[model samples]
Target: MQTAQRKSLTMLRWMMVASLALPVALFLIAGYVSYGTTYEEADREIRRSLDVVHEHALKVFETIDRSLSEIDEIVRDLTDADIKAREQVLHARLRQLSDALPQLKSAWVFDAHGRPLVNSMLYPAPDMSFLDRDYFDAHVKESVGTFIGATLTPRSPYQGAAFFSISRRRQSDDGSFTGIIQTSVLPDYFEHFYARIGRAPGSYFALRRFDGLVLARFPVTERSAGPAPHDIPAMAADTDRLVTETSPLDAIERRVGYQRLAGYPVYVSAGLDTATIRNRWLGTMSRHLIFGIPATVLLIIFLTLARRRTEHFYVEAARRLEAEDALKHGQRMEALGQLTGGVAHDFNNLLTVIRASADLLRRPNLPDERRQRYIDAISDTVARASKLTSQLLAFARRQTLKPEVFDIGRSVVALRDMTKTLVGSRIEVVTSVPPEPCYVNADAGQFETALINMAVNARDAMAGQGLLSIAVAPASDLPTPVAPHHRPPLGYVAIAVQDTGIGIPQDQFSRIFEPFFTTKTIGHGTGLGLSQVFGFAKQSGGEIGVTSEVGRGATFTLYLPRVAPSHEPRSEAAGHAAPIGGRGMSVLVVEDNIDVGRSATEALAELGYLTTLVDNARDALEELVGGASRFDVVFTDVVMPGMTGLELAEEIRRLDLNIPVVLASGYSHVLAQQGTNGFELLRKPYSIEELSRVLHKVAPVPHHRAPPVAPNSEVR
Candidate 1:
């Protein structure tokens, strides 16, 4: 009776198992099948949408081409006219064309001398001197067709709107050259067209020169003042073909579609809102879950009773695997941090060398133009160093900021040129700056560095085969400069660096800005990028926020305070010569770094000052104390091994009370003391001019006279 009962129970269990398994197995298979079909259909829809988008883009290009062609024909007619009668005909034609083409702000004709033949204004006889603009010079060499200038809003003659010039060469019927025809297009016309092309929010449409200068944009902001993308590699590879790519801009996924103008090499790009499309899919997916989850749960419950042992084993195994993965991740992160730190240190040293060497190259002996070139080189090198330092600081949390009011649009335009060095030849950078000035008060240098680093991080994430987009604009509805609780209005310049690379893992987003945290392989990332951005934003009295996803991309924003209403950014003189002494005097120079010390001494000596060199601050004090016939000035390094230069300066004051002292340091804080006769400070790696000024201020030696310096033009 017991054996019979056990057999009956076993049979019942088997039947229960089959009953549960059949429904779940069937449902799972059916669910997978449905998913496969849905995925295929969705993909097809996306492709179809993309095709439609492409076709619309082609039409837009064709329209622009047609408009340009019409302008070209007009230019030819104006050029063929006789020079003597050019002014009258040009005036009549310009007026007619301006009336005919409402898109035009004005039209004019310019002779070889850049003299305006006819102006489109009511009072057409304005001074021709102003007519000799860049457009005229650009058209002077045009063999055929027209050249379009970057958009500009003429504040005078026309007001309250932006405009860009298109210049076409004029040739006579006999092939002789006459004047050139020019037309200025109002921005609103193109802006309307741009708005229509991809009306989806977060989409980007822009016109850029082959060199990456932004010509026009649909949505604009203050950050647009910075650099945009136009690297040689991407553009070089592009011919007259339409290319589609992907990137992240503003923390949103985007698809870029571009075509070079058929005749002109100008590049026009449109960015599709990937998130919008993905969101549409997500909504669909969410709907499936609403229905599918209950079905799945019911099936699981039915199966669970019969296959409880199998379920237990599967769950336990998954938990163990997750633990193992966590352990491996921790080990990997620790290794990456160490590697990133070491690399940053070495890179910093190299940057220091490059910066210092560039400074050295900018000597007074060079020609004014060459000196300017070297100065530019030095500027470029400093910018590069600043970028590297930002990366290190972002990684290490040590960046300092010096804020100023600036146009973000200008800055981004400039940065586009620099992206090449950071990302190399593989990545292309694109930018869109609004016509409205993006005014913000922040550390311009640091802000720029933040943008560049973000770009580099994006590039690295992309593995050098993607597009990096930067967009600058005023933050909408951001607080004004003085809202105590709200961050002061930075005019809210938003710098967004986006990339179409492998994106951040959802679980790792918060850690991205943490010191030494990374999602990269063991040696790939030190994970300081977002952190430095965070630190930089906080230091500049700004904020940083990010949005990212796995397998998509990321966008980082840095918001800084806008310049105060009453405050305007001061225009700095390109270079200042340190004022030399009115009377010659002997200066005692003390520094431990031989190279720095020697350079200082030599530069001082070159300025006609007698210099005494010592190895440290103590020797400097002794030299001053050892004589009643003391040196006129003491220039000493602030930091040394034993006694700091500050302590030594104090000792010298106790002995030779009247001797003037100027403290120098690589770090600025050590030279903080002021108000005493011995209280002047100078920064190291200073130029000869800087040293001369320090001496003149501290020790006014009676016989000292400044060396005759030529004007800036004569510096070389």
Candidate 2:
């Protein structure tokens, strides 16, 4: 083990050394590659600049050549007899050509004797003897095509300034040379044109003849326009269009591009200073090194630290995973505890009332009025317990829903009395609703319960003495309040409940909607109130929001999706007499719990229904299939042993039995999960009045005396 450990340590040290050395090797390779690329880019840019300058220079030379050709045509047509007559015409044309071209210095016609016949600059004509000019001598000897003269200081009309001439041989109709028609261009013309090309300060552009005599140079001086030095390389090399050369005039190193102008003996060259290119490349390389060095150093430091902390990292990661598991488990347990405690507390209260009432009735001396009162109290307490369970189911999103489109404004107005009662006389209740009805699709009872919950919360916050206001409006008319991780509805009908009370704090906002998360002291609140409201909003495809500032007031708004108005009014079952009895109609009670089954059967019997109780869905199915007894309605619990009530209902349907099925459940996911399959559902802990109403609606006996009320009627 000790030998293995030594070898492992040596291997790790080698690996670390290799890791550090690899980046350095890569850095050196990258630097070399980058330098090559930078050099190529700089060379490309210089060539591109040279191309632009060459194009401009080409245009200048072509213009000059075209003007010379035009002059030759005019001179070719001139005859001795018509020379005096055409002199004025010829001079005017030459002056027009010179004026049109900024580069042309002067235009003139010379006779075979080398004497100027007409000059464009001197109006009437000057006594210019051009026989001494090199261009004049060339035209007199071998005057055939055009000839570009070397740069020289010309006398007379040119003002003794250095200029070059492009001369074309003028021939008579017999093809005999008459004289040369020449145009002179000063070096300043090229200087001004080159300046516009916008090269670097040290850069240069030059026009030179085929024999290496420079005709024009940008930043021109007397010294720049001269013969090329013997030491300079040949400018017209076929393979060397681009080259690096030191200027004879300034001794500055430059990258030069050369191109010979077409139809002329002159060549144009554009150069870029090599020093400038080198400086730019160095700047870029320096920047890369400046940033890369520190980054490489930091990487080495990080690797060293990472090796040192490897064990610690593993330990911390394991600890984090354990902590996360514990936190999630704690959350699940807390939620479960809150739900169980709330349900237990409510059911225990109802049991206490029922137990007390039964004990009172057991007394032999109990008065008839007192006995009836105790029974009534027991029934009312059971009804309250049923309502509490319904609210809890709704909060859990498991309750069966009967959604309808109704006017939200009218619903708020209908709840005015109820809101007043909930807040009590100490708090003033106010309501504001638009005259125009706003419609929404939702379970009306659940919506009312949510609204009442909001009002009650508001009342508690106000200490039951502040003002409580309920308003109904279109969602478009209200400013939507922001909530963390909640999406606002597009189109909705907003119902806002506002109160003048001690507002909720910012720290408790996220937890306000959690189950059993109440700000009130224990026994004063169940904390499921807001939870119910929150669940109702989400299940209805909407959202809920709250806005509160401490010491000011609080407002809770419920936004429900808006629906198009329907012409038909919603028919409600309230304000009608409920059916009192089942009229001896038979019901099949299928429950897994023996006590629940017996109690349900007894309740149905009390409602004038003959109920046959069964312990499970299988027993109930056996009786129905054997035809031992026929039931008017198949009233069965949703969850049962052997087979489920939903499956039993389906079997009854397959049997073609005309009996209606009513399902009941204390709390089951069947209604929320698999759906109701069109069967009516009655929540557990139902009252006798509710059972009677359901029985009469499903199967009413002809002999019954009481008239049937709406199935949805409540004993509010």
Candidate 3:
């Protein structure tokens, strides 16, 4: 009963652990996946934005290129004096071009000596030296078709602020460079355009020259032109690629995409800040946690409450059942006590009459009539005593069975508790009756007496301490006979008694049920217990059979003709405390030597423990974590292959602290060097008695009916 309860609690523990752990594990994995997804999203967004910026910058640069071509065509074959003759017309043309484009600040026509001839800002051009400007210098050296220059800060009133320049060479008819037509492009134009695209957190846009100089950036920097961010080599080579780098302009890390402006020497960059991406991901996870955590908690709470409620119901049922068993056992023991007392009193009276009559008859020279009467009195007393003895036997359920329709299950269950009182407290008696009633037409008293007889025999075989299991079940027929015997065929209810004790020898099987035959020493046993059981089985039109091994335990089954249920067979329902004497404690035995291992396993079996034997520690652990049986203790050898017994003990504790370890060894350095470490230890060449004693101390007992001080003679 306790074993079942423990198993139930273990199942609940596993459920509780799964409820919390599955969610935690899921969230952890999801966190990693979501973070990566967010990064991918940022990369994609930046890439798309850079495409738009690429088209925008390409269109702006193309406009400047086209305007420069138009100016260059007008001034190409003209000398300085001829171009000065048409200055008004030229100025009006430059002004009209400048008016049409917001990005273009001013357009100018310069002479070969760098004297500005025509200008859009003024009718007469300023006296600026062409030798000083990068656009002018390149055009003069050779007939450069068009050139884009870095930003130039204004040094005169003609230039108001920093501006980039685009210029084309004004060549002669022979294609020699003479002068230049220049356009001043405002950097604020691109900056204002980027501002309209909107700022999202740390997002930014940049336009940089192919020479690694910034033309303009939004979230505008301290200066218009400076070295661009690190990773300029990758930026220059992979024009349409994405990269991650920190912006020197503001020291913000971003996932940036770069696209080179078509037909221009500059690249347009758009980036999504990493800080922004991380913030977005955190929000998503927070929402998930908000929903997930509560659901997990509620699940755990539900399981906990359900387990508690189930335990409460079990406790209440157990208490009621215990109360019923105690009352029933008390009543049976009292009735038997009264019967034994009355029988003994009647036998004493009969003996007194016989002794008195015999003594009178022995008197010498008595009268013949008197002598005859004395002899008759002795004879009558003797006959009466014989009759009284028969009555006693009948009361003890040894004479004749008065068959009646009664529930075999109920009879066994009732007698089972009293049987515990008859067997000593040292032996553990466990009962397993089918929940559905099993009925038969047999003497209820005789059946109970038969059950008690088997239990007493089991107790003696165990030397007072072992497991005695009484199980009742429906059977088709008796088990195959040890030696073939006529057994009533099929359709029987079987009552079985299994004992973990020194088993009977196979050679002695046939003689076990014969009258006056016994395995026990003289005076300790009367030898009629099994014979009586045999008689009862035969008289009731049933059969009794047994199976045994020399060192292991034995099983005896009594099969009776089954009585089909007419109605619900009577039900009676037990402070059957769990025994610490090791009854039903399962043990995992780890020993490498096969012979020694078998001997140890058999010994534990005799000591009333269910055991599993393994030659190595690996197998032992496999049994511990994976096996269906729940072990109460681990009994292992100290020196074995793979993991030592000490190591196995540690591992067992790590897996389940409730199960304890007991180390066994003849002698090993492993044991000598590192003591038992608080574990129980048994040395080699141990006796069966010592093994039983130690296991009784160490095992976690299951709850079952304890044995009584003595088995009543009526049962035997």
Candidate 4:
């Protein structure tokens, strides 16, 4: 569980990190894309406006050229003296052309002498020297197609607004420069048209000569600026281009698109201020951040809260588990204390009896009858000690068992008379058995002992006056709490011992199964009866439960898995078998304890058997397999250091030795779980009669009796 909790917490932490990290990553990507998109849109819009200006400027230049060409054609064959003579007619035609075109301020004709011949405003034009003007001198010096001059404020006729002159050179038929046809073009004409093209604040529009000079501008600023803040691109080429530079008029940075009028020596430019472009980008990002940051923050907050809550949950769970462990530890300690005290008290009582009997027997010249009685008393005390130890082993669930299938209903019914006599004639013993047999597989002796224990406990509860009911019936299964996890829910036979006596209390319910816990006052009950019942039920793949109420009868139910009816255990003969003489047959005794080995060999000799003894299984095997004296049977202890008696038996079986192997053990975990593996078993603390019987059952019968080699025995 702790590992799983760690994994869960680690997952939550990673999610919290991602909750913040992922959105930031997405926002950075979005910002980069939107930044590019904003500038590109401004560039596209600026280029479009410049395209409109380009087309319009081209038409204006072409129209003025056409007008100059027509005037030139009219005076092509006329001489200068002839042109002056017809000045009134030529002036009227010029005035007519000027009045028709709104962009033209006036038109004039100048002679090759750098003198104006006639003008559209005045019939006989003012005698002004044209050589001083770049427009007039440029045609006289070079053979140019058309000359677009720098910006100027015209003399007096239309001098308020700035306009530049568009002039065409007049050539005679011999290709000599005669004069220039000059026209004053209105800059307001282009400015007003450009003003109509929509632009945001700090934007600009302009028409410039091909020589990088500003000719006309919208929202015109004073030309008082210092050096340009950044470099200007060479937009004088025939192709259009985009440039980012400071505006010369305002010293503000702007992105400009320059388009040259097709087939003309003029260019039109449109600009959008960088600040305005950035504002547009900021607006888009502002909208995104307005939603994105809050959402990301909320997600982060949610993850943080989840992390905190998960930490709290695990902390509380750990504390609860710790508390539970402490509780179980305290309970086990309490049970151990009770078990130690009870075991000491019981053993001390048995020892006192044995000591007293031995002391009585040590008197001088004791009577034969009294001596016999003392010896019997000592033997009985020893038996009691052995039984106490057996109960302890049973409570620990380590005692060996001989399990067989038997009808449980008949078994309990047969115990009715004995229970009545034991519980006493005062307490009524009742038996309830189902008509159909309920069979179970368990140790018959333990089952009988458990029943009797419960019966005796009921007698004590009632103080020998209440009814004791013993019932056997078919039980399907036990409660979920009563069943162990490793055991499956199988068909069961339930034996219930109900007593109408002082009932068990609820507070003592859990301790009832603990070793040496009894309700009867101390010195009145030994307190191992119910514990034996608990251990027996568990070892036999079953469960035991109790239900009781104060002042009401209590019921202890033992649930054992039911089995198919089998052959019942037949009664054995009362007489013991005559001791077989083992004069010819030899026995191999394998015991780990030195005292046990000596005692076993001596006992075999008393039983008229020749014996060989060894402390461990290895030497026993050598004696049986390769020793000079061949043995007819093998006896070995089950638990030893290197090789267990069971393993030694199996090895002998593999050797295919015809000798029988008898296994002996007091308590072994292997024996409790897996059983004897089909070998004759002598339980620990066995007497000579029991050992002799087991050996007789497994070993060959000896026919010849011989005098045994013993220092104290008399030969017959």
Candidate 5:
């Protein structure tokens, strides 16, 4: 019995030891993986910083080259006598050029013997000689196309400021060096630019010649503008793209990128302090250690206690889980309620417009002008309601899209007036579109709706006062994928809406697209606007993205797949014309709703068409097949209780009936599921003019000389 008890105690001790060692091993592995990830991210950030610096440096150099070229052209045209005669005019021109370019400290013309012929500042030309200047020496010996020389302080008139000369050699028609046109650029100009771009304390950028002579450096020290150290690393010499080493000037480790400026012998380099990189990594690691150590310790303690009171812990955990599930259910219910309430509110407003317009139209003594106004008001309200329904369908991912290839840039330009009206007068609307068209294949209506939605969102963000800009351009790179399985295509056309407003908070990024998620006060917004835009972009084979800084602004970009130029779709304006009158045309109307069927039948009859109405497709088919009724056209709704209108149309084709069919619907999942088979589709709440036009398109009737028939008699 004593042996058995001792063995049991030993096993228990081993089990406890195993439990403690497991968490430590796992945590250490996790820490290693996390640290490696952070290091790689830091390296990538360094490369990005280098690219930005390189671009800025290239711009500065280009400006210098252009200034020198202009000076060379002006000097080459003038003879020595012309320069002496027109000296004042020449000086005025140089001063103008200098004033235009803040980077240019001064401009001067030098003779082959290195004497200043004309200076940009002051008349009578202050006597100056560039005999010892490298730029002048190079030009005098041989024609130097363009050369940047060492830093020098000017003499007398231009004293007290350090300037580097960028010189262009001027030649006569005989191909002999005439003179050098030189422009002095202030090093402080570049220093300020570098300072703006470099955010970190120790981070710096430098411009150096091919031979390692430093021209400019940020955090300017006396040694920085001098020659580079003899022990300069190979990365800073020649055309080495990027390297990580200890900087010779500051004796600090840095990761640097260097590039030779295009058309110039000098190189530009940007470096980030290795100490800053390491400090960032250390801070991240410290945070993990701070939370992770205690969490691990607590986990171990909990596991030990859980093993002893397993049943009790399980009961408590089950209760907590139940409570969490209940909370989640409540949250879901709230979201659903919000969505429904928003939809209802918008629909109610639309109904108010329609109801008020109809009530005003019923007034007996209304003038012809007032009558027309009420009629137009009702028509506009119906169109608005249709748009609302379309947006709701888009949010539900069931909108029946009529995709066509069109120029996106042109389309956005066309919306400028409408966008201005939507956002109102307080906000300024600006548009930037390329002169060349960028074509994309998408539903034009939905695309326009998306733009309108974005503009409204921007207006709201600005609180009714700000600048709203809409820009369309071809994207160089694919947009970031919004979903894990989404693989972006090779190219896209981006429509971006930018605003100066109170920007979005970082924490709301993930929830911005949720159906009912919003930051606006209740009754101020519905929050389905962005959701519709998101769904439309995805369903149209594209993606949307947003970038915002807390106090700066926000830009929302919609990326649509680009289409070939040859496939430019026809515009809607081209399809509309004066409505043609129907003269005793026969028609078959099939609709499921009683009120809709009655109204349609009466309207067609009033328009001089003999009409027959049925509630379902089967009845309409029976009437067509069995009755002695001759029909010129068949008009039907897309969705119904039995045998959908699309199917009915298909059957008519199968039966070889020589009749045209027009399908109409408010919102049809069927139209989205099974596309319309070449049948003309008229969206619901269509105007009488639209109805007449579509009928004339499918089946035409000549004018009748007989008197107008009564509506009740015309309906059969």
Candidate 6:
């Protein structure tokens, strides 16, 4: 047993360590994988921001290219040398042409003779010729390139601080050198373009033309100034090497994007400080984390709970295995019980023969001194055998009982006295019996055994040196009806045994009553004591309950039904006249088994009665109806093949009308309904005396109840 327990403990330890380590390792690996993925995603998000800034710079360059193309078309058309056609085209046409392009401030044609043909101003024209001007020379010499002049407020024609341009040698359909045309473009056009690029808050854009002029300054008004604040030459040169980079802006330690406009000689620096961008990202990321964190936490919590449930399943499996083992152990004890009960039954019959034979031997034929010695030996032997039978019945739980109403309080007080000897001097035994009688109808001997068993258990629990308490009172809480045949709210007697000892653990409490279940050393206990108590309580229609704490002590309480009225005890009819010598009354005994039928007939023959025995109920009925067998009483076993004894008894009542029928069986559960006449029942395993007594009680002669008459005085 110790080896088995050590093996169980070792398995449990390995299970516990596995239960703890496995989930921790798995979750740590999972968390590491998740953190790595999140970090990579954060890095990808930074790269995406760089791509957006690069795209914005390309948009700025496209705006400038579109504006330049519009102005070039107007200059090429103005050199047509059709002066009359230009004026007749109306000022509306000229204004429409100028407003058609956002970047070209105003446009007019000045012929090779140096006269203004059209202007995009209020009723005015600029007196200028681009025939020898540097813009004209540059345009004629280059024919396709734009040459932006110096960064100064323009003279005369379309004023308001602009940069002028020229285009010449425009060919008609005949390819003639018509004239040189000049136009001015405003810096506001570039300013408006930068505004469309849309800088971030507290940021700006700068557009630089190829000739080193800061064409526009967003968020700064400097229309009269020539060159802008920052060096445009270096910025424009960096156009090819203008990689978008995040750098600290100004004196403040903040991060922003700086990039040269793609496909053009201009610089666009539009960015927000790192703090501002971080604050915005932080708000968004905080909201994401707020949701993600709880979801992750909930997932972890669910995983932990699942782990706990797995542990519980293993624990439950162990408990079920223990329960199955306990069940097999109890079955073995029950088998032992059947064996002991069979032995006791046969031994009792032998003892009965010995006792009767011994009585018969003590006659006057033997010597007087020898007769006394033989009688003494027989008496001692019989007494010893009686003790042996008592032990057998205790083990088998099949003792004959004379249950009677008794006060449990009286019983507890007596037990307290007995426990003092059992528990020794070091242990204190206390008892509390209620003032009211806690009465139960149970066999006194078995009740004493139950009390002794509980006391012994308490003694063992205390390790020979603590207090044992026995309390007797009315049961407080009882279960409701478990079945239809339950008795009413009759009072119950509670016998509680409590010990200040090594207490039982909560998990092991249910197994304590199982037979052969023990936490004791070998040779110390047979493990039948509590099982006997359990069987006794069940046989007496009672319940047992237990309560315990780990280090504190334990208490077991037995609840038995309070004594109620029932059949009175049968007093032996000691002396009677020869039983009227049995005047040959016919008795029909019906039994299926031959041994039992022959036994009945032989026992009946000893009473000098005529008997007809049959093996089947159908034959018995036929014999009775044939008028050959006039039976005074028909004795039959209740359970038979052809028909039950009750059916045979019913048939006998219908045919013979007044014949008394006796029903006998090993089972008491098959008794007929009470108050049914013409039939009486007898339980099995009866002797001649029991048979004779039941026959006399159930089918007595009619004259047997008559009062005794004086023999001499007669009927007077």
Please provide, for model 4 over 363-399, each residue's C-alpha lDDT reduced to its tens digit, 9 standing for 90 to 100.
9999999999998788777767777777777778888
Candidate 4: RMSD over Cα atoms?
A: 46.4
User: Highest lDDT among the candidates is held by which one?
Assistant: 4
CA shift of 285, model 4, Å: 36
lDDT of candidates 1 onward, in order: 0.62, 0.75, 0.74, 0.79, 0.78, 0.60
Q: What is the lDDT of residue 283 in candidate 1?
A: 64
- Best of the two (5, 6) by TM-score: 5
Index of the highest-TM-score prediction: 5
In candidate 2, what are the lDDT values of residues 1-716, reduced to their tens digit? 98999998797787578557855776678777877776676567656766776676677777878887777666666664456567788778889898888788789877777777876776667655678778877776665577888766656554745677888877776767687788888777887777877456556677777666777776565544445322243344434446878866667887777776666666777766778767766777788778877866775567656445655877999999999999999999988998788788878988999999999899998889999999889988977887777777777787777678898888889889988987899999999999888888898888988998999999999998989989988875335544422333446788889999999999999999877778888689888889889888878878888999998889999988787877777756522255477666767777777777777666666666666777777777777777634567778888876788888999888888777889887777767766778887777777666667776767766332322222222211
Question: How many steric overlaps does candidate 2 have?
Answer: 0
Residue pairs with clashing backbones, model 3: 321-574, 322-574, 423-708, 424-707
lDDT of 5 by residue, 1-716 (tens): 98998887786666567556755675677667877776677567656766777777777778778877787777777886688678899899999999898788889887776777787877767666767887877787677677888777766666646878888887788878777889898888878888887777557687777776667886676643344333243334455445777756768787677777777887777777777767776787778778877865665567656345646876899999999999999999997888788778888988898899899989899999989898878777777777777777887778878888888988898899999999999999999998878888788888998999899999999989999999998885555544432344537888999999999998999988877678988788778889989989988878899999877779999989887765443756323355555677777788888677778777777777777777899988887787423777888998899799999999999988777899998778768766687898988877767887888888886332323324343323
Ranking by lDDT: 4, 5, 2, 3, 1, 6
State how far residue 367 of model 5 sits from its true place (Å).
6.0
RMSD of 1: 23.8
Off by over 4 Å in 6: 1-471, 479-487, 497-508, 515-541, 548-555, 563-586, 607-610, 623-632, 646-662, 668-681, 702-716
Could you give me the TM-score of model 2 versus the true structure? 0.51
Error in Å for residue 83 of model 1:
73
Q: 264-354 in candidate 6: lDDT tens per residue?
A: 4444443334454445555555565567556555545565565567679879999999999999999999878855654565467657756
lDDT of 3 by residue, 239-333 (tens): 45677778665778877787776556777888878888999899989999999888788868898675566579779999999999999999889
Clashes of each: 41, 0, 4, 0, 0, 1
Which runs in model 5 stand beyond 4 Å of their true positions? 1-311, 353-377, 420-429, 481-490, 566-579, 626-629, 702-716
Q: How displaced is residue 484 in candidate 2, in Å?
A: 21
